[model samples]
Target: MSNLEIRDLHVTVETEAGTKEILKGVDLTINSGETHAIMGPNGSGKSTLAYSIAGHPKYTITQGSVTLDGEDILGLTVDERARAGLFLAMQYPVEVPGVSVSNFLRTAKTAIDGQAPKLRTWARDVNTAMERVDMDPEMANRSLNEGFSGGEKKRHEIVQLELLNPKFAILDETDSGLDIDALRIVSDGVNRYSAQGDRGVLLITHYTRILRYIKPDHVHVFVAGRVAEQGGAELAERLEAEGYDRYVKAARAGV
Candidate 1:
């Protein structure tokens, strides 16, 4: 099975003041067939870890290494990381005004696979994936996420996940703006993809709601950019009951 490993990852970004470290020293490992959930409060660096692994330009890896199957990916470009079997579902999917959803998916799939898929089969696969996510087939001809609702944008992200079938998927708060029905549909799509038993998922979120539909094997509490606690499904239940207050207090007290 493949493995996505992060080692003492420290990420920073430039602001008006100066370089500020978002990830202090984070370490986590997600193997194929496993789903790990990162739960934390706001400004705790959950999304920073996701973007860092995806090789986003805005975040700089000041120290630490991220590797896929023992190959360091810090040196790879954003597209190179994707080609290496990494995918990131942004917390806020941006609008691509001119790029039609169908064309965008096809182009991304072609880029990751290193060849253009046969048109007839590609079209069918796209439709099938979109259907799985309850996305309107007609919307495929529209600009990517340009006029879509929050739920639609999130569903479109899942469509990409289904079509691209990356080795690892880093979902950054995919459950944020989705309603109950939409949440279940999106969760089902994720489950279908992970059921292949050869893919890894690192889902970052602020709440445990999504965990009900997408159960993670491991639950980690991120506090002040570091993993404060690790446990099983029970941990999520505890978080739901107790909240992150204790974790936040502990971090503040330097516990």
Candidate 2:
């Protein structure tokens, strides 16, 4: 039973106007096989938490600790963190001009596993994962995310998620910019990954539409850079019906 634990995590970033704090003492624990949904308004530090956990250098951790299975992850580099079984699906996946999708995926898998996968089996796995995400087979030859549509990029992220099979995954706004069909496909891919019964997922989003397909084991309402309320799936339904107005008001009042 692996666990990702965040204890009083406070993160900040340097901007043109000095440093600005984002996460304000967040504490959460996600054990293997649990899916946690973080819903919040804009600028509420949702992505910051994801990036921080992924070891992005831009975000500075001023206080608190992040641990994976009792091992301190805050001190690990981004690649080291990935090797430790942490994955982050960015909202905007960047383009790699020269790296073919096939090469990139295989290379990442080899690095993580500390061994090169058998050529024939790795090719078969890559093709199977692409088909699972409804991605074109030709995409394997194209440079990663270069000239790809938003929906395609998102699908490609899921492709990586399926093939790499990380211990924990943090998806930041995965449902954004996806059409109905694309959303369903992406959600299905996520569902398949979570079905493994030993992977933890942190799904961050503003809308509850995705929740309809990917039911969260726990829903946390993020407000003012902190979790204001947390409950079961019913909390997500209420947020869908009532919106974040009440949470926003309460956050503003410092309640």
List per-candidate RMSD values in Å.
0.7, 0.7
Local distance difference test values of all predictions, in order: 0.94, 0.95
**Candidate 1 backbone clash number:** 0
**What TM-score would candidate 1 get against the native?**
0.99
Q: Which parts of model 1 are misplaced by more than 4 Å?
A: none
Q: lDDT tens string, model 1, 181-200?
A: 99999999899989999999
Model 1 lDDT, residue 242, Cα: 97
Give the Å shift of residue 121 in candidate 2: 0.4
Worst 10 residues of 2 by lDDT: 246-255
TM-score list, all predictions: 0.99, 0.99
Model 2: lDDT equals: 0.95
Q: How high is the lDDT of residue 158 in model 1?
A: 96
Off by over 4 Å in 2: none
